[model samples]
Target: MATEALGSQAAAQDRTAGFGRLALTALRAVGRVLGRVFGVVRPVAWVLIAATITLWIAGQSLGWWELTVTAVVIGAALLLCLLFLIGRTAYDVSLDLNRTRVVVGERAVGALTLSNTGTRAILPSRVVLPVGNGRGVFDVHRLSPGEQAEELFAIPTSRRAVVKVGPVSVVRGDPLGLFERVHRRDEPVDLFVHPRTVLFDGQSLGFLRDLEGLPATDLSPDDVSFHALREYQAGDDLRHVHWKSTARTGHIMVRQYEETRRSHFVIGLSTSPADYRDDDEFELAVSVAGSLGLRALRDSQRVEVRVQERALPAATGKQFLDALSGLEHSRARAGGIVELAGSVAASLALASVVVLVCGTKVDANDLRTACSRLPFGARVLAVVVSPAGTAPSLRRIGDADVITVGALEQLPLALRKVLA
Candidate 1:
């Protein structure tokens, strides 16, 4: 009897669990159906539904035939609107950017091509494009079968950013504003707007001097400046042999010349948010980095630009600017200037000078610590991009020169003082 009772209890429990699962499955199916039904339902449809419910309640309670008839009419209209807005149409859209990358303040233009691929004429519709945080809406006219239309647009490039443009969405709606449908037509494209760079005429004067007749400590046999005579090695160039010294000493002696060191600048930009007081300060720092790198490149010197862990490849002209355009502030609290210093020291051994571009939030101690990690004899410059209204100042942290600029317009002047 005890075993039979136990078995009966187990059977009841199993039946209850099975029923619960079946009920959950039914609820999910119903939810999916309702979701599909309401997904395309517009605001007008919702108002109609509410009015229908109210009218039906009144008709049942007060036995009003007029309210019942009115509710049925609204219900029929809603159904008809949904039927017209549910089907897909044959339309194709293609976006072509004149250029995917451009400098700040330059015009970025593009064209949108719309084609009607179906047999019937496509009714007038609105094309919506997602541009950055905003939307672009263009009214498109009716297109007959095998007909096409093109629209031109210019993307705003007043600031440095990576702006996303479209997955083209074509909006179709009823004339009565009862229902609407959207068809996604194209993939998104990225436009890179590079930071603005200042053009400066003065030469860089600090670390590595000009290769034209510049004296240096390191001696080489192939350079121009004569240093001392040494015993000729097997691989020494024949032209470098000092014939007078060789004849006097009765030994093969080659002329040694001091190697002229040309400046190779490596600009390190700290992207950590903690290093910047705000977005404006960060943008100023980026512009400073770009301007300095461009100046060095203009002078025909080797340049390397680094933001966070990534190093902008060795490039000049548009390619270099394109790399700078994509620089963004780091969301994570990664190590700021100190970490950047360590990375630069480890990787760029041949760098003649290091330009550290940061915001006003960094203090003198942080700057000093970062400069300490740099290779010996490398000139270090710390540029602090301060907020507007602050007075510009110049100071030194150990061997590194620190220059503070209140605004981007003041960068050229501050750079002259530091670089001089």
Candidate 2:
């Protein structure tokens, strides 16, 4: 009797454990399914129900069918929402933009190809892409994994802004179209929207470039493109005298060299949100730095971009501009932009011009010292982007020109003046 009782007890314990596991598994599955079901209909569900009931009161038998069909339309909408949630929205995507450039006020067209990889062809859906304005929603109704869909969007920014346009959301609806399933696409892709460049105040950059020689130069050179000619003088080199001009005028003329000087401008950007006056102000500062850096590059002088999050080395290449585009703020000020270009990496401090994007005034002293240490050729220019007008101008620390800009749209034009 004791052995039989023990066996029965063991059997009962095993049955209980099995049932518990089965119950837990059922609960988990039900939770997921129900969550999906409710998520689909929760938006405007009451309105949809009210409409269905009103139709029924009017003696429309098809109203009932509409309600039932909406509930059953789960397959299509659910599939789409699943695509976004699971991050499997597209099989492939491409960024189609010109590598060289598109001028300011010109349209920039980028194409993306989303291929369906699933066995069944996808029906109708919409994707929210990241354009310059913080969001770009694309409509894709039909396509299979192997098939491709072409979409287009306009970048409404005249200034250079890094546009990151990916991780689109795919939304689907039930058969009756009463419910929508939201899916967050997992694909990681982005577009770097460069700031639009323009000639400022009727100042021709081409003339400067040609007179100064190539767009990239560290030292100034002397070459006679065109300079005022003078009558042949004893001190003038005979080689410079033009025999043809001498014959035409019956007097010797010497070719004079044009004097072109290189600009010394430095631009520093900060990504620490804590320092910025506000979201818009910080973004404007970044845009200003980028615009100035590009212009300095074209001027045949070294341009440096130092962000609190990342620092670009001095004597840097042009590619650093693109890198600056995707800059983001950090949680801690562990790596200070001022220190990176100052005590830590002082060699990068060599510049004839300095531009600091003021977030907070924490590193104001360090930046000031760096600018002062530079030769007389270098002058530091600072811009304050504080929303509440709290950020102090750098003039307190040194002889720096400080401008408080209210918006990022003002950055490009402002930098143009500062550089001038």
* Candidate No. with top lDDT: 1
TM-score of 2: 0.44
Q: Candidate 2, residues 166-222: lDDT per residue as tens digits?
A: 566676654445566677655544445444333334321212334343233222123
- Can you give the TM-score per candidate against the true fold? 0.73, 0.44
Predicted candidate 1, C-alpha RMSD: 8.0
lDDT of candidate 1 over 1-420, digit per residue (tens): 999999999999999999999999999999988876676678777888999999999998999999999999988887776666643455788999999988889998999999998888887887888889998899888899999989899987888988989989988777677777777888999898988777776865344555563466776778778788999989889998889989999999998888765577889999999999999898888888888887787777888887777888657767777777777776565689888998899898667889899987888898999999986667788888987777778898999888898777787787778756
Worst 10 residues of 2 by lDDT: 198-207
The lDDT of each candidate is 0.83, 0.57
